[model samples]
Target chain A: MRYSKYFLIIIILLSVFNLYAEKPFKYVETGVNTNSWALIPAGEFHFGQHQHIKNIDYDFEIMITDVTNEQYANYLNEALEKGTIYAKKDTIWGYHPGDPFDAYLHEWEIPAGDYPHMPINEPGLRLNYENGKFSPKAGYENHPMVEVSWFGAKAYADYYGYRLPTELEWEKAARGTGTNDYPWGNTVKRNQANFISSHNLFAKMFGDVVKTTPVGFYNGNNYDGYQTVEGISPYGLYDMAGNVYQWTGDDHPKVHYRYMRGGSYQSYEYNLRVWPRNSAGPEYTSMSLGFRCARDID
Target chain B: MVEWGVKDITVKLLGLDLESVERSGRIIMLYHVIAMIVTSIEVYMITSIVPMRKHQRTNINATITVGWITAMIFGMAFAYFGHNYFYHGLFLVGQSLIFFAGILLAVTLNPWNKHFLVENKEYAHTKNGYDLERIAFFVMTVSMLISAGFGAVTGSFWSNGHETFLAEDLIRQPDKTALQKSIIGYLHIMLTLIAIAITLIVGRWMDFKGKLHKFAMPIMIFGTLVISGGVWSVVWTHMAHTFIYIGSTFVMFAALLLVIYAWGKLIKDRIKEQGLKNPSFGQKFVALFHDPIKFGPFWQMVFMNFTVSGVGIFMAVKLEEIFRVWPAREERITLTGHWHIPAALIATIILMYYIDIAGIKGKLRKWLGWTIIIGSDIAFAAMTIMSMKRLFVTEYYQTPLVNWTMLATDFGLGIILILLAGVLGWRLIDLFRSDNRWSKESASPELELERTAVLTKQGRDVIKKEMEI
Candidate 1:
């Protein structure tokens, strides 16, 4: 009897100890894409000088862009084909996302691996403006696509088996190499990138026609004459501050929405600021909205 | 540490006011020690006063009365000390005396004295007045020193130079000195050690002496409560409020039941008088199945069916939902709830079978007695499992049915365990008391009667010649 009592006491104490121990939080990594991006190992980075949190400062290497459309599409296709839906959903959402609707709204199809079909002529669909679907306009396939909703972006990414970037990652990329705001050292100049004040939204038969410029065409005002005028995010990415305001995966509770980065052609100087954040519903889509990709590595 | 008796009780006589905590501690310690010694004397008399010569009764009665008076004085003394400290002192004293007496009883009343035989020669000769004074004295002296030592150490920090009357005040101060804290720490370890020692001694005695009825339950309770009390005294003396106080009082009452139980055992052993004669197997075993023929198997089946049907249905339905295999609410309301019907039917059929079999007169005559004994035991074990299952179910679902069922089952199990323990104890006592002699005349009464008849016939001629004059 004494031995059993002591034994029970010991067991109870052990279980209580277990209850107090630290629990490891589980997180899975698959940046919004089908194809695996090169793992960006954690390291130091030269972020904005004297502008970051003081006293506790360190440079951290982060994914250069938000997770992209193509990568997510491929992951979804692979997962569906491999009969790995449970894994695809479990490591991401605890439930499955219903299939996406088609252009005619006639059917919902679970997209095949890496073969996501971009909707056509939808009001929010990003157009290859340089090729104009048929006419030779400005902006083409090489340019970053736009008009994706935050929800659509996350679902698309999860479908292909990837995750959206955290708010911290988006901030890191926007900060670029310097602490200055628009990835251009606190300067907002028309000579830097395309904006409503500098670029056309429509190139019609009228004078001073408003239209999107071809990708990398802001050559006359090359702030850093690199391989291409568009490929500079202050931290060196193509058209980060002024291409299409890119959709980020970061969600803010009070905002009840996520963020869009990079000013649109119709945006003002404030909108063009690298730190400026705008809320968008997960389902919001527009011509001047797009996203980039980031990958996580241990 | 050694508090012999009350001293410096007259507050005015001490040349100081009665508001001194130090004086209070001293008074309380003294009271505790005296009370424990007196209680120990009563316990000792109960065992040793039995099987006595004619004149020993007066002395034994006087000792018991004095012991009772001493206990009353100690109870009053607690009012003077803080309730917390006083109860701690009381229990410490009470448990110590009981622990000593229990061990002594286990040693003296052990069946081994008769080589486990009810009719051994010593069993007939050794009537009562068996004194374990030496062991009793040793335990009492040690327990007093340890309990007083613990009280002193625990009460030290509150012992400012005044006799604090308010119990709450003495317990509230938190900034105790390191020396005072260490004393409290040692007291816990000491109390635990004593409780454990008592448990071990009684447990071994029960196993060797076959006193499972008289001793095992009390020993188990005493050991468990004292250890728990020691732990609580160390951690939550001041924090224990009215509810805790009342709950603790209830536990003490339970402990009192154990002491009462021990006293009853001494009398039943006829330790003070001639030992009771052994009963024959037929007389004993027949009493088990004689009247009102207890067919416990019937009741056991009823309870078993109730338990299985209740829990099995609940688990099947609830777990099916958790696994997402249950039909939708609408479907369940109409169709799927029928799944529980078959198990319910099976349970009913099993219950019916038991009732039918146990109700027959021939069957009761043949097998009813053994069925009840074994069936109740099985039922007890099954009920304990059901109780645990109900607890698990309530943990998951806070519905009214589950909550009420859990409480009901828990209480049911506790009752069954205690009742079954009683039955087992009675049977064991009967086993120990029965004549185990191997002589043919002692073994079979029928054969012994036949042999006596033959002897009488053979001696008839010699008997007639002797009676001729």
Candidate 2:
């Protein structure tokens, strides 16, 4: 009986050590209500093409889905209350000092007195603050947060002890270790991503409600009641092709514009390729723009 | 300067933000208004200038040529505004009106006189006339080149990077590299200079009767096609500035070609034959109607008319909530009227053509013409009244009076249209009275007799000598 008890105690001790040792690599950060991230194992990736082609090596953990409106609002409210971040209404003004991207510092605040009010669970509330509380549009809490300036995205990343993914990191996660043009493979299919199609003129004319479908709306494979496959990148990142354009940590070579990766709901199919790159002014904000956070695997 | 401020106020009152009004909006508005005025002046001048009887045929051809050029300009402006500022109702209306006016002018000023060339023989190859024509062509070419140069240097071609008030949320700074800007600028200037050089060559060679004339036609046609291809490339590749410069180059060449054809009669004279001589106005009109596909200028006018009407109605319907021109009832009425008027006119034209083909004659043909005239007038009057009611009587005028000036101007245009319709109706009546049949067997003899009756003794002798040859 004494020997059996000793074996049991040792097993328990080892279990505790294993949990602690695996803590930093875990997809979910402790005490944070953010979505789970996927690990991008350390490896070399073929980055860019034409004059920009190069091999890039990176190791990081990136969010499986883009940062949701609810999580961003929660972080914004917390940072505002703690006096760590300040908002200047109706003006877009902010920048990340140490960022290597050389993103132009510009203003991008939502217009003052124009915030819509809805229950925190309403779908169309977008970004709104009323009566000392910040909330996403009511039913769209799960939708990707958009209209956030590059600086705003960076600020949220900083507050959460994470950083925006570098252009190389983003492309590596999207293209995986292979040279596939898209997350699914070389060929693009309509069902693979949301995009504007010339064949569906009627839908285009009327404007489809499916313009920005809920995150993980397609290409999801459920395994044991968990979304584990379908529409997933080789690195297990969801929405690595299209949902919203994700801000990356690189600047365009000839301008004060930051690089954006993947594509948005309004993008054409060819534009969603992992090889194609686009850039916008850092202060640019639109309903089709958002960001996902990444952290280095220490 | 005062008018400029008024334009600013007008834009401000149209619901644009102050920043937008001050930036690109005011400038675009001024361009639209200036283009309209210039088109009007050109139309008036073309219509009013009646060269001597001998030069009348050439003048009519010149009118048609200018009309086509004006239509092309409006078409380009329409495409530009539609691609860039489609959401702006005021600009949409302005562009549509310019297109509509172009078609109206083309139709009204179409060359109809049959004996104009024979009458104006004295003016042909005259040194004084050549001097005047050369001087005018030089001035026009120089002006076009200078304007294109200015546009290229001012970054007008770089439309993609232009900053606008409504687009302030997404600031597009100037292109990153000075080399890129300079390259585009230099290319634009070079193409413009090439266009000017070609114009000078074509104009000078058109007066000659040798190898250059044979080569000119093929060269101009090939150059136009190549330049048009360049325009498509620039637009597709998103080289915004290059698109403008290339498009202007195409326009300059097209205008030069038209000038040579209309004034010098280089193409028509080459193609002329014995059977094609002294065609009556009715025969000419029928020929155009039967083979509209071959009539480039006429087809262009038809395309512009349909586009203007369709786009005007679409804008009216789509922007109803924003413009607030009329109540629900009047809006529906106006929308229906807009569609029905064009449909009715087309139906009338078809009906008249069939009747004429069937050899309908006497009072029956005259009655049909009168019926069409009355029906079109009634439809036009209804449209005008509805427009006026929307402007003055409707309770839902969201914009101020300054902003309503476009609506008022459109209403005034109705009178001009009614008068034009009357003139066309009279022409149709005259056609019906002159000949009940369009058979070539009957038309040839009638044309010869009509020619003999109309020609002077010298003209008749010249025709007899040509026949003997």
TM for every model, in the order presented, reads 0.25, 0.41
User: What DockQ do you compute for every candidate structure?
Assistant: 0.01, 0.01
For every model in order, the fraction of real contacts preserved is 0.00, 0.00
Task: Give the C-alpha miss distance for residue B323 in model 2, angstroms.
Answer: 27
- iRMSD, all candidates: 31.4, 21.9
Error of 2 at B328 (Å): 39
For candidate 1, the per-residue lDDT at A66 reads: 32
Compared with the true structure, what per-residue lDDT tens digits does model 2 show for residues A1-298?
A: 8599999999988864453331211121112234788888876666653213455555679998888878888987887688665555533233445324333333222222222111232222265777656776544666788777677787788888999998878888887777676776765555555554322431332223323545664444432233322566887676777778888865444344566778876566656778555565565555667889999877
Runs in model 1 deviating more than 4 A are A1-120, A123-139, A159-162, A200-231, B1-469
Candidate 2's iRMSD:
21.9
What does candidate 1's lDDT look like per residue over B1-469, in tens digits? 0111223455434332222213435454554454444334333333332222222333333444454454445544554444555654554455444444445444433322321222222112123322122222233334434544555555454434322231221121224444444344443334333323332222222121223222333343344444444434544454423333343343334333333333343334433243436645554444333421322222332343344435444554565232121112112221222222222222222222323322445554335344434444344334334333333442112233333544653454445445446544644665655452224322321211101001123235554676795
